[model samples]
Every structure is written in C-alpha cells, then in structure tokens.
Target: MKRILVIAIPLLLLTGCMHLNDPRPKHYKAPVTTVANKVCVIVQPEADEQIVTIRINEIGNDNNTLEKYGLAVIASAERCVTDFGYAFTAGKAYNFMVILESPEKKKRGVQPSARIYGASFSLWRLNGKLQATPLY
Candidate 1:
C-alpha cells in the first residue's frame, strides 16, 4: 500500500505540472491601411465623467496614395487612454485602427514629422452584439 501511494503521488504531480504550461493564444493581425476621407476618433470618459479631447494637426498626403491617418492625444481618468484616442459609443460597437506614418525622407526642419510605426484594434460588447473594427 505505501509503495502504491508514493508512485501515484508523483504521477499526479507530474500531470498537474504539465497542464500548467499550456500554449498561448495565436497573435492578432492589425490592419495595414484604411480608407481616406473618413477618420474616426473614439473617446471613453474617465470615472469622473471628464471631457476627453483629441487634436489632429494634419493628415498628410503622399503621392496621391490613400492612407488612413490621424494625429491626436488621449486623456482619460482610468489611464487606459491610447495615443491616438479611444473609441466610445454608448450601446454601439466600435473599432479603432491607428497607423503611425513614418516621417518624410527629405525635409530638414526643427521638428521632425510624426511617424506611425504600427497599428492596433480593440473589441468589446456593446448593446447586444460583438462589434470589432480597426481605427485609423
């Protein structure tokens, strides 16, 4: 009886350890570009119900290429605000895609162009369905 118990304990411990190292979930793909002429900026107010603001300096145009672009800062109470901004729609699903454009190659000035390196998207439950989209 003692021998059997010892072997079973070790086997159970090994099985538990194996389950702890489960594989991670697959990576999510971000949008490359978005349609021009339409730029969406979503804002989620803080707990205090403070007013959120976004400032877009200039949406650049490169060689007639249509790219989703914007420049702005986010302010929120929960400190969960993103660089571009947050998407907040009461009872409606929202998606945000932010593409950081690289600075112009040939331009010498005091301030360099703001280059967007990557983009991100968020999904959440709003109203009665799941709506997810990229914001740029």
Candidate 2:
C-alpha cells in the first residue's frame, strides 16, 4: 500500500509539469483584389462650398466594407485636383465613371456614420483617365 501511494503521488505530480503549445495559426493573410463594378461622383455646388459625393457602387462581395475604399477614393480625388489644378465648373454639377480596386474578401463595415460610403481608388486612377459616360 505504501509503495502504491509513493508511486502514484510522483506520477500525479509529473502530469502537471507537462506543457502543451498552442496550435492556432499566427500568420495574417490580406484579402485578394477584385474588380469594382460601377463608380460615380456627384459634385454639388453650394453658395459657400462645394460638396463632393463619390458614389462607388458594387464593391466586393460585401456591401459594408466598401466605405473605407470609398473615402480613400474621395480623398484621392480631392488631392488629384489640388495637385493638378483640376476642378469642376463652378455652379455646375459633374458626373464621372471611375474604376477602383477592391479586395475579394468580404468584411463587415464598421463605420459609425450611416452616411459614409466605402470606395477605393488610387490617385492615378482618379486622375480623369478612366472617366466614362455618366450613367444618369
């Protein structure tokens, strides 16, 4: 009986010393790139300021994830005109078709603002090179 207790206690204590490493994946893979469907921009001329509304429709498999890309395109458009002396005719609205790059993976849109839209376009792409006839 004494021998059994001594051996059992040692075995039980050794079991707690064993270590097990985590087996989960650690690498991060970015979403794949896909072609955007439709792109449009609306420039509203106000008395004091011009409001630019860039509409990027049909972005990726997920409808929500496009806003980030949309804002990026808007910023690029603003910067493009600023850097290259591009501006819409004053007191007039303008429409344009743009091609944007987007990721294939679907992700949930997390913007707090309900009005915010996500569209993605690079400075070069938004440089009036890819403009098409207005769908409207």
Candidate 3:
C-alpha cells in the first residue's frame, strides 16, 4: 500500500505540471487593407495632456511581411482615436483600416497569469469618413 501511494502521488504531480504547460489559444485577426494612403496623426494636448501609443498591425496571413497600416497619438482618450483633416489632400478621399489587438495575459513566475485584454481591426477613412474607395 505504501509503495502504491508513492507512485500514484508522483503520477498526479506530473499530470498537473503537464496541464500547466498547455498552449493558449490564439484569438486575434489581422487588420484589413485600405485603398487610401495612411498618414500618422499626432495630437498634442493643450494642458495636462496624456499621450497614448497606438499600434496598427498588418492585415494578412503573411507573417513575414507585417506592416503598420495606421498609427496615431490621441490625448486623454481611453481607446484609440483617429481623425483626418484637410492635410489628407483635398478632393482625394482616403480610407483607414485597423486591427486592434487585445492584450494577452502573460505568465509570471508561480503566480496565475495576468492579461490586459486587447482587440483587433477593420477599415475607416483618414478624413474621419467611412467609404469603400479612396476615389469616392
């Protein structure tokens, strides 16, 4: 009985460790492409400004050629915000597509993992308008 108990305990410990190493599911989609040219917009606040870092992941399965589609800096905004002004070029329309990625929880030491939760993207316009084509 004593020998059997020892072997069972080790087996249980090994099984527990094996389950801990299981890979997490990849739940993210790539960003969509836009016909309009992309321009980086940096909005500075007047006073007590807050800066944000926005990431625009490429939209496609080609991992080797991932490019940043749209990037902008907004002040005091909770989520990512983009606006297109006259600088986008008069008469020529533009579109903006984004893939918002949710922050993932990473494992740290023996404690449970921590995750910030992120989102991914779609398409919009550089002029703050949603259109199918840049020419429109």
Candidate 4:
C-alpha cells in the first residue's frame, strides 16, 4: 500500500504540472472593420422577472457571409429603449450579446481588401433613462 501511494502522488503532481503549459492563445484581437448599416435586434422572453436578455445581430450583405464578432451593450440598450419602450422597473439590468456576420469583400480594382467584422458589449439598464457600458 505504501509503495502504490508514493507512485500515485508523483503521477498526480506531474499531471497538475502539465496543465500549466497550455498552448492556446490568451489574447483577443479586435476587428478591422464594422458594417453599421446592416444590423438587427431580437429580444428573448424570459421567465425570470429580474433578468432580461437581448441579442443584437449585425448582418452581412447578400452573399450571406456572416461572422459573429461580439456585442455592443450600450447601443443595443438605447435602441431597445427607444423602439420597444421601457416598461421594466428602473435599475433593472439586462444582459446583451452581439452576433456578427462576415461581410462579403469587394475588390477595389487591383487591391484586395479584407474586412474583419465582430461584436462586443456590456451590461445595460434603464433607470429613468437608458444606459450602456462596453464590456472588456
């Protein structure tokens, strides 16, 4: 029993050490360009009264090349409050996420341009007014 216990402990320690050398990239890259004109917002009905979720979609062109970059919380909250009207309680916060679609690239004569489109956003709410904060 003592021999097995010694062997198992060292193996466990080695396994734990192996996890410290993870190879995945730790940083996030920002998008190169954003297509503002093509955008849409969808609200999801929630069973919970305290929390609400809204999904914002930034769509690409006719080619259907779309990529979800991230969410813009403040912009979405403002649009929702303006268009949908605010009936929720003041100080009640909502969660928002942005869905990004890849835009079709156009070649402007000899130069080929690639546009990186994505989304990002933060928490928001309406407390006598609409507010948004960009998430990091």
Model 3 C-alpha lDDT per residue in residues 61-98, reported as the tens digit of each score: 33322234333233432222353232333233233333
Expressed as tens digits, the lDDT of each residue in 1-136 for candidate 4 is 9999999999998988975635332222222111232122332211211112233322222232222233322332223211233232222232223322112212222112121212343223434343433333
Where model 1 places Cα greater than 4 Å from the true spot, the runs are: 1-91, 104-136
Return whichever of 1 and 4 wins on TM-score. 4
Which one wins on TM-score? 4
Residue 108 deviation, candidate 4, in Å?
Answer: 34
Give the distance in Å from residue 125's predicted Cα in candidate 1 to where it truly belongs: 4.0
Clashes of each: 10, 7, 15, 15
Which TM-score value belongs to model 1? Answer: 0.21
3 or 4: which has the higher TM-score? 4
lDDT of 2 at 126: 41
lDDT of 3 at 33: 30
RMSD of each: 15.5, 18.3, 11.0, 15.2
Instruction: Compose the digit string of candidate 2's lDDT tens values, residues 8-114.
Output: 99999988866543222122111111123222332222122221333322223233221212332233332221112223221222222222322211123322112
Between candidates 3 and 4, the one scoring higher on lDDT is 3
Which regions in candidate 3 have their CA more than 4 angstroms from the true location? 1-56, 61-110, 126-136
Overall local distance difference test of candidate 2 = 0.29
